[model samples]
Target: MAFTLNVNGTDMEVDAAPETPLLWALRDHLRLTGTKFGCGIAQCGACTVDIDGVATRSCQFPVEAAEGVKITTIEGLGAEGEHVLQKVWTEMNVPQCGYCQSGMVMAAAALLKDIPEPSDADIDLYVDNICRCGTYPRVRQAIHRAAELLKA
Candidate 1:
């Protein structure tokens, strides 16, 4: 089936099966590889993307369901790391291995949207993306820094 997905403010057409995961379509078809594939079951947030302004796991999201929804990948999150989260992530050096940074950023972005001034507990409750390099502390700091940057 051919599906038209609104990605990064642009409408692109792609051919995929009804149950094809959105992650494959974005990476294989749209050629947007910023969204990584960690765990296919959505346990890991490596394939996280912004769907309709919410952080969503793309690994399990069917391509057909993604049609007509606004999907934003890390590449679309900012123009060359201009987004607050991106800037903070870079400045704070959030990632140790960096494989999960994109997904972490997406999750953080959504958390900030919902809770502009999130507490430490809020950070723990949300932003549950796994990091194999044990960068949780840095991730939390980066999110806090990003929130401060947003205020400034």
Candidate 2:
């Protein structure tokens, strides 16, 4: 099947099966590899992306389901590397192996977009993505830092 995907403010037409996961289309067809593939199942957030401004697990989301929806990957999140969350992530050193940072960043970006000043509990409850390097503390700190940066 062929579907048009609005990715990072660009319209891209890709030929793929209806059941093909959005992750594959983005990585394979669109050549957008920023969205990682940690777990094929949706349990892990490594394949997280923004669909209509909502953080979604792309691994389980069918490609056809994303048709006509605006999708944003880590590559498109920041402009000139100035996104508050990206700046904070860099300042806080949020990645260890760097495998899960994309998804973590995506989830954090969504959380901060909705709640500019999120509490620790809010982060805990909302950012459920896993980081194997035990970088949760840093991730939490980065979220707060990004929030502060946004406020400034």
Candidate 3:
């Protein structure tokens, strides 16, 4: 099964089953390993990727379902890691272990794109990726800082 996918502005071919999780196709077939697989179920956000501008869990999403959609993994966030959110994440030192940072950044990016100056409540509601490292405070701060950077 060869599926031609539009990922990060490029059309690439992936040989995988229709029901194969999009995470495996991205990581194994496409070699885009930035999207991590924390849990096979969608409980953890480590496998998040942007599907048509929405943060989608790649772990459960099927390859066929993602066909023809614009898929953006952490590697696609910006060219050479220059996205505003990435910059803010670095400056704020948002990650402790850095395991969940990719998903955190993707979720935050989606949230900020929708709501530029998100309130703390909005942050609490939108950014739901779990981090055992307890980096929630820094994640929130980084989102705020990214918002500020966007405004400038």
lDDT of each: 0.92, 0.91, 0.90
Candidate 3 lDDT at 39 equals: 82
Kindly give the stretch of ten consecutive residues in candidate 3 with the minimal lDDT sum. Answer: 72-81
Query: What are the per-residue Cα lDDT tens digits for candidate 2 across 20-121?
Result: 999999999999999999889997899999999889999999999999799999989974657788888887788889899889889988898889899999
Winner of 2 and 3 under TM-score: 3
Q: Pick the candidate with the highest lDDT.
A: 1
lDDT score, residue 47, model 1?
A: 97
TM-score each candidate. Answer: 0.97, 0.97, 0.97
Instruction: Give the distance in Å from residue 14's predicted Cα in candidate 3 to where it truly belongs.
Output: 0.5
Q: Residue 13 of model 3: what lDDT?
A: 95
> Roughly what TM-score does model 3 have, to 2 decimal places?
0.97
Across residues 33-140, which tens digit of lDDT does each residue of candidate 3 receive?
889999889977999889998988899999999887999989999857799999988887888999988998998998998999999999988888889899998898
lDDT per residue (tens digit) for residues 7-93 in model 1: 999999999998999999999999999999998999999999999988899999999999878999999999599999999888888
Ten-residue stretch with the least lDDT total in model 1 = 88-97
Better candidate by lDDT, 1 or 3: 1
The true-structure Cα RMSD of candidate 2 reads 1.0
